[model samples]
Target: MGLFGSRGRRRDIPNNPALLAAAAENPGGSVAEIDPAYIDDPNGYVPQEAIRGSWLVDSGGKLTGEYEENPRHGVPQDDFSRLTDPDHWLGWLGDDPAAAVRKGIEESLRAQVADAVVEWVKILDAPRFLTGGRRHTEDEQVMLVTRAGLAAAFALSVRSTQHGRSTLLGVFSWVAAHLSEPQGRKDRTWFDLGVGLDWAGERLGERIYELDGTGGTVER
Candidate 1:
């Protein structure tokens, strides 16, 4: 049983009992029963993209506090601030204690960003429009241009040993950027492979990509 009883998923409606009661009249109703008095147009549906964006941004903000502020990690909030500050660059570590701590922090934050990206857009890998394999390939291509990876791409902007410049961040940035845009199915370049790569070039700069190719981004 789910939160809405035996239904496989909850209807996308507000939590108001009156609204739910009115919506229950439809076979799979969500806000269809919403009172006309409260809405400008009775036919309008909520934009799910907005909801997804809110969740992702909110999750990012939470990461700043939830994991970053825990005293046990030995990573000071000020240190974390310096690490995430846009003016600084992120790097990799092999055996240093500080490196390990920063690595853990970076890995956690990257996962949070990646998870948010995945949730933001439910990718449709099926062969829609007869694009076949290209449709599935599209999602893979889009995952490549994470801006965090670009920031860590050995640029001259700002440098640091903090793991903030990991490739995961880059992936997050790309997905977020795509979701951030108001694109429609009619937009020919919306999911174009070249467009995604071009965005990557702009975000990543030319150097880091020359060093780190697109081979490992899709892996765990």
Candidate 2:
């Protein structure tokens, strides 16, 4: 009995007992890893590596909890602040930063589907970071941070007319990979992040959430 009542193989998230427990009553998809470097500090500081917990998606394709069993630090206090030094992004943007970003997106898509074919895919924008602003909102506890504030937080959204499937770890792992690939041809002189997908117009699935490289989604 999967999310949409479609029978599929049972999958598990390795070393994530917390995530496993959370998915106990639901169908499973791909298992993405949680990166410790992307978590925020107790003082509301967004470091080069600041992201916390895993975003839970239920069998019904609804957004659920956004934290782990025990949080490493408290929620961020300020809505605007320097996430990290700009120089930190130099190492991430390699000879082909844009392609790297694409690879990360493909990785996330692969994580969700095991046997199902993607058919076609689309992204709203290239990968870039959210420098400073109330991106996560004052009430939201998930304070997304990247290397030198070089990237923004993203969530994986899958839409289908039929339901009953759960993407195990969401897109946490996909977001982690993008941290090393900024928006640039072959330089790190600038810092920004962007990654989004929508398959609604096709009619097989509709856009439940839009990816604008910013804002909140079911994953990331």
Candidate 3:
């Protein structure tokens, strides 16, 4: 026999009046029970794209078609100019690290500046950072900080040897500077950094995995 009664039989009714009163009070409220078959539908509703138009649509209602082809607008000119200028894309060290390191403390300063610039770029793109739909429009400051930060990160990453104290200090100093910046405190910046770091780490891990596999086995 079970605690209540027999296995097949219904349990004995509760003898305690207080327990019965509590049970009566605890009646299940209105619950719209959904059919299991309704949830089992394979062709369920799926959300569609929220935005339909092209990203390049201008405020003037003009499409960005042939905009790249127009030299008069300076779009093509800017693109070509950037392509011609290798220095624009390449970081601080460029093709030469010896020269950058020889520059000494200035290199560290430049790294801090580079980190600030990266933060600034991310801030510019972020909507939450904007005040009344307007971002910080100080172009000169933006350019200056960006250049400095880029130079610093590049110098530290390339010139600083792994086992050296000075190298570690330089790298940490750059990170500190990045964190000290106003935009760096923002959640968005941290989120972006996390994403970037994860991606870079993943790529490096994949490369290491490949190298380890190659190091282990040789096919006949």
Q: List the residue pairs that clash in candidate 1.
A: 146-170, 146-171, 147-170
RMSD of each: 19.9, 21.4, 27.8
Worst 10 residues of 2 by lDDT: 200-209
Candidate 1 vs candidate 3: the lDDT winner is 1
Instruction: Name the best candidate (by lDDT).
Output: 2
Off by over 4 Å in 3: 1-88, 91-98, 106-167, 172-220
Computed on alpha carbons, the lDDT of every model, listed in order, comes to 0.25, 0.31, 0.23
Task: For candidate 1, write residues 28-89 as lDDT tens digits.
Answer: 32222222222233343221221111100122222111111111222111122222333322
Model 2, 104-220: lDDT tens digits are 544544555544322222222222332212224556665443322233233222333353222211111122222323553121221112322221112111111112243332221
lDDT of candidate model 2 versus the reference = 0.31
Model 1 regions more than 4 Å off: 1-201, 207-220
Candidate 3's residue-wise lDDT over 1-220, tens digit each? 1111212222334354543443344343111112222122212321111111111222343222211111122111101121123333223333643333334334333454432211010011101101111123665333222111121211111222332111111111111122224464221111122133324333332332231222211111
TM-score of 2: 0.21
TM-score of each: 0.17, 0.21, 0.13
